[model samples]
Target: MSKKRTGVFVCHCGTNIAATVDVAKVAKEMAGEDTVAFTKEYVYMCSEPGQESVVQAIKDNKLDSVVVTCCSPNLHEKTFRDNATRAGINNFTCEIANIREQCSWVHNDKAKGTEKAIKISRSVVRRVNRNQPLDAIAVNVTRRAMVIGGGVAGIQAALDIANAGVEVVLVEKQATIGGRMLQLSETFPTLDCSQCVLSPKMVEVKRHPKIKLMTYSEVQELTGSVGNFQVKALKKPTFVDPDKCKLCDECTAVCPVVVPNEYELNLTARRAIYIPYAQAIPASFTLDESVCLGLNPIVCGKCKDVCEADAINYDMRPETVTEDVGAIVVATGFDLYGQENMGELGGGKIEDVLDGLQFERLCSASGATKGHILRPSDHTEPKNVVFIQCVGSRDPAKHCAYCSKICCMYTAKHAQLYKHHVPDGRAYVFYIDIRSGGKGYEEFVQRTMEDNDTLYLRGRVSRLYRHNGKVRVLGTDTLSGQNVEIDADMVVLALAMVPSKGTTEIAKVLKIGRDKDGFLAEAHPKLKPVESVTAGIYLAGAAQAPKDIPETVAQAGAAAAKVIALLSQATLSRPPLIARVRRSHCTGCGMCVDACPFIAIRLENGKAVVNEALCEGCGSCSATCLRAAIDVKNVTQLQIYEMIEACLAV
Candidate 1:
């Protein structure tokens, strides 16, 4: 509402900014401009006395606002803000010119860099002159979280949060909570049954008073921000409602329609109205919408007629349930690459070919053919089995340049499993680099070779094709420099790991940015790996990158810690630099609203109001202001403009 008696402090940053730019020349140059009280350049403006210098200058010059031309605001905007605020000026009155990263870090020519830095300073001064005093906003955190996946990571997150005495909603896309872990008979190296370790946790999740498990459900839409997120979950009609269905098989026995069971990776058949598996959580049966006579084509309601509990609802339609949560952990695990992604690997075309997950399901006792590995084409067993490694992953030529870290271990596990079950089965593995870098990982792979009698070939499988009923794998052994071919009863492809197809969807929903590969981008690669670049949001599991079980679990725990720490605060503090609306001058064209991926801006009392919690203060919204009506606090155009005018003092 008032003009700030602004002081501008330009940082030389020890040649990081000074070497290319004539810092003093530009500082003097900008001091000659109007609205510029004084301008000076210091060797290290972010240092202790350097920061105090700005505060001293603010006090000495009787300045209400200060501009510091230094590194990206991401680094030290807050430092200047804090210094200015402590010096009896509003923190938002301190504007930062990003000369270091945007100018000096990229540009080599000194004169050009100095000129560019001055221009940037001028822009920030111009923008900040229109700044206003804004208060931070906070909503009551519900002390609740919604975790979308029920896998080990999700389960761990739910258990931790529930144990912390917070309400948790654990939603599973499947009928059970164990996820891919349950598909495995035993974990590598430890040789412990996956279900034995996971079932107790699953049961604990079911019994936890603070935890609500929503199985066979999907989150349809997510609205709001951290501490105030509203989610709508579409409870796909299971036909057999949990409150009424007793999980009895009487209805399944009478159902006429049967299809290849997805639970068994399509190696077995399930009735049209079948429970996902014997130990399906909530233990409720689901009628297949595609095949149920009544629901499928509106032809078969046979399972309903014979039902004693009257659980069948033939007209059951998708229902939406909305809940408020303080935070969201996107544990929506991952799906293995299907036939569509593995065209070069002879994926669905071969009856015996399977992805790593399908192979796990195929070998389980609950799987099709009852744990006897056989070709789907003929159900016959053979002596030779070949495992193709890096099928869809780790191929730079295919855009999967980075290794999917889990493939090597899991492929090795599959080979050992085949060897264990087939007794006389010969298991051979082809690979490029064996990345068993996790704890107990190298030994696990070694044990598979030594103890399990599995052979490992260091190379790639160039091609795979079906001959007669069996598939043949052809590749070269890089170690021996020999062309190798194997005809096998079954061939398992360790498909490449890519970010989930929903990665982009989650990014949009969160209003966070993602890289070209679609995995979540961290705040910094080395400094802040678990945290997203967007404040108040954290990342976990394969959603962040390709990781094995251990790494994924560890990241999940890290994400939980971040959430707990954030919620633990009495109230969160945001950066003083945020986009502010000039209400009288505002047109409310909604350009800023549309441009904001975070949904930070909304109409309040018919005028624009920015939810400080949602705003990232990226200045994208300010740039979109048609009338230049929107200016970011502290870093307004006038402040930047004057700072530039002062920097280029002629």
Candidate 2:
């Protein structure tokens, strides 16, 4: 090979790195290398002038490769790449050495930090020397997007993406599109009716021509990569034709079978043939085959007989559908942490104790008690109600360690709602600390305390038990330094928000990573909050973390924006870095196939072949090949050896 020509540029990053590390000394050390054609220092390498200088040097010296020593590559790698491209050098020939975060911020000693920076630059230089010019391969993009989950987040994302003129497939696991948001009575801070606000979006999703709303459906399998994905969804049988059904209550009134309504948290009863609620999006009825008497042995067919529109069908079977899309949005939302195992909090055995969601149902106008705040054990109204915050949150010993972000604000809202309903009722909120970080949230909490006369105590509810027609709560007031006791008529626990059920399974299907707490992992917590590490797949709402309504909607919009951007491209450019297999060294052990997480490799004609379009350049197959038959296109064994040698060079 011809002699290598390298250019190095070090950035001060506006005193972020210059304050600790000597930028000029690091640049001078890099220039000492034999192949170093040019070296320079700048206050901000990402600035237009600095980039132009690097481009000018590459042209002036006819340099083949460049090294930029600056902040983390995550921040400015694209800027430097664009600079190299504009300067007539291949973008892949440029490498970035992070000195700001890895060297300066972490180290206190200036000399040591400078040494580390020089070493990092040397390794990058060696790596760039082995780099070859490569072109980004083009793949056709499908102008469509898929949204999982039918909650507020999913609805928002589907609407936004569809509004951008891209076709959207919204797959909902429930019979209705509205998820937990429909169950809520009134939203916090604004006090707007949850259904009133969410119902309009639900209708829009159902009516939009570009949006294909699939309720009672779930993603069974996901295959392919960004810009071209095949998703198979299983549509569960509702046993009632949505198109033919008139959504009248005639069938529900005549059905003899009665079951607990899950939407009401089992506090109310509904017929076996029923709709989720009055404002259900499709305006259709669903027959629960499990509870219906007509399905097995045919004891009764009253619902089918009573249907005026003749929409009942007991023989309906599940159907699977496949869709092609360019991008996917995961807005599966969250589930409240269960208190069944929390024995200290009465283990949900107390007659009048309930979770936040159940309380929300009770406060709703369509609830069992007609929106009256009555104790479940009796039909009478409760004179005293106790609200407990952080029941399953911030308690690493028993539950999750992270704070359930919405609990504090929602608990305050719950207190205010209760006060509004029962003028003579006394509401007591026990909390470790109030976290009202949203707009108007702190003032809303204050209104609950002062205007509504609700009592806020700083402490945790240690225990609860039924005593003489009242719930006895035992805990201490940390602020007052006093042991406290209360005999309450009802109790509500603000359970932690956990990633919804089957989220992990879905993540596995999509080949996406999740944090230890089971939430989908973002590419970067700050910069790439909405994008998942997996390309073309985005996250929104509580699926990523516990976020309130406004935040969830904003994230949904952000994910939609990413989808729109992806769909806008006429053809997507697949990374040039991908694995390659040598047919001559063929020992079709198939081990590499199992090791390939992206499923980009397969055995054909007794030799392994790679699907370059599907490959993510992860290099797992290359590492697993025992006979050295596989090698990643740009990253090879020789490059790694050269980098290590350069790092250890005296």
Candidate 3:
């Protein structure tokens, strides 16, 4: 509000910005301005020494505001903020001018780039004068966690939080918790028994004193911020008593209605009322309400009549549960892209074509085919099976641009599993690349190639057609750069791994960011991989990105560590950079109110009140208001305009 006393620091950026623009000339030109307290330039202004210039100027010139003309704010805003705080200046008093990425990175002409940089710098100075110092609103965390999707990731997260002496609520949409892992016969590389490794985690989550496993449940509404969140979980009726039933197979064997078994990937017949698999967590049976006796009541309660536990609750109704939590881990995992189309690939049109998970089940000892590589059309063992990879991945033109990171490894694993099961069975794997990049990953691929007698052909299939009880595959060999065709008794498609179906829903509820492909977006790729853009919420497993078991487990640990870090604090302090409106300025015209994005602005005491929790410190509200009443603390309009006046000599 007083005289404009400004300082500008231009970064050489090691020729990133310096090569095209004259940093020293720009600084000197700005220094000539009467309002400018001082102007300086340096190489790597983001570097330690460059930051020192800002602090030194703030003290030496008694500057009222600071502008760091560097790269994008997204990269190092926090760094500059911390520097300002260290200098006894309000962190928001500083503003970052994007002269590098937006100007130097895009423009080649020296003078034009420099001119554009000045314009941006001037705009920021104009904007920052309106900025005011705002404090971050810190709410007490409940110290409880919610994990979505009770697969391995959820199980691991729940166990970690529970083990740490905190409460965890796990929600699973399915009636069981095993997820696709239970469907698999063996895990890759080491080929360890899938259930053997997964079952222990599931049991721990179910039995944990601090963990509440809610199967057949969906999160209907998620509200509040990271530390103190309230979630409404919808528990759909399973029609069977979870407490009474002891996982006896009696109900399934005698049920009158028989349908295709989804657990077997629908390869065999199963009663309508049945458990997903033998090793299902909770290891209990579920009644398919659509076909079960009690649904219409027209049919008989044969399952209940047969059950000695009287576990059947015919009057069961969907229930809603509200739980409070301090943090959340969205490890809902993923689902394989359903290859229902690509009629040429025999996706849903043919009987013998199966996805990777289905094939996993078929290869398992507890599977429909009893660990035999058999044709679902007739239950006969197949002598030859063709594996198709990248069904709906890596092609932006068709399915998705992402590579679905786990597909290549899992397909190789599938081929290896097929070879192991049917020793004499010929396994031909069609792939785009072998992406076993993690620990023991490369060696695993080599072992599969050398020991399994599996044929690895690098190519993409053009078409597939079932003829004479066999599918004829037409493809091109990328290695040989030649067209190839083959007929196999059965075909296994390694479908693309995709984010869970409820990913978008969860993203909206949690307010955590998500990229275009539906995978949860992290705050920063390298620096904050496990953290979501939203604080107090962490992500792990395939829900965030397509990751293998080892990576998923490691991420689970990282997420747990983050929770522990948050809990470690004796008293959380909200950073003093969030937005707040001046209640006394009082012209409730509502222009600033409409501009607030996070709904952090509220009508409190009959006036427009800016909620510290909702404000992003973006200063959008300050920009739109005609009255100029809105101020984003520290980086206020007065200080920024002073900086601008200093820069322009106006």
User: How would you encode candidate 1's per-residue C-alpha lDDT over 575-638 as one tens digit per residue?
Assistant: 5467889999787788888887678898777667898777767787888888777777766666
Q: How many residue pairs clash in all the candidates, one count each? A: 40, 0, 19
Prediction 1 global C-alpha lDDT: 0.77
| Cα RMSD, model 1 | 4.1
Candidate closer to the true structure by TM-score (higher is better), 2 or 3: 2
Which of candidates 1 and 2 is the stronger one according to TM-score? Answer: 2
Model 1: worst 10 consecutive residues (lDDT sum)? 292-301
Q: Per-residue alpha-carbon lDDT of model 2 for 1-650, expressed as tens digits?
A: 88789999999999889887889998998899878888999998888888889999999999889999999887788789889999999998988999888889999898888888888888888788888888989999999999998999999999999999999999998888889899999999999999999999999999999999899888989888899999999998999998999877898888889899998898988888889988888889988877887564367878778888888888899999999999999999888888786799999899899999999999998776778888999868888899999999999998999999898988898899999999889999999998998889999999999999999899988899988989999988999999889999999999999998857777988889899899999999898999998889999999899999999999999999999998999998887899888889869999889999888888998889898888878888878888888888768766777778877874
Candidates sorted by lDDT, descending order? 2, 3, 1
Kindly state the number of residue pairs that clash in model 3. Answer: 19
In angstroms, give how far residue 4 of model 1 lies from its true place: 5.4
Order candidates by TM-score, high to low: 2, 3, 1
List candidate 1 stretches off by more than 4 Å: 1-63, 104-111, 296-298, 573-650
Model 3, position 462: C-alpha lDDT score: 87
Better of 1 and 2 by lDDT: 2
Structural similarity to truth (TM-score) of each candidate: 0.86, 0.90, 0.89
TM-score of 1: 0.86
Q: Give per-residue CA lDDT, model 3, range 1-650, as digits (tens).
A: 67677777778889999888877777876666556677788888777778887787788888767778888898877788778787877777688888888989999999988877777776665555555654545656677888887777778877887898888888998888977777788887788998888988888887899988899889888766667777898998888887899777788777889888766777788887888877677767788877765565456767777889988778889899999887888888888887785656866788888888888888788887777777888878888888888888887887877887777777778878877777888988888887878778788878777888888899989888878888888998889888988888888887788887877678887777898888999988898999998878899888998888888888988888888777656556565555556667757888777877666676667567777654667788888767667776666667567766645646
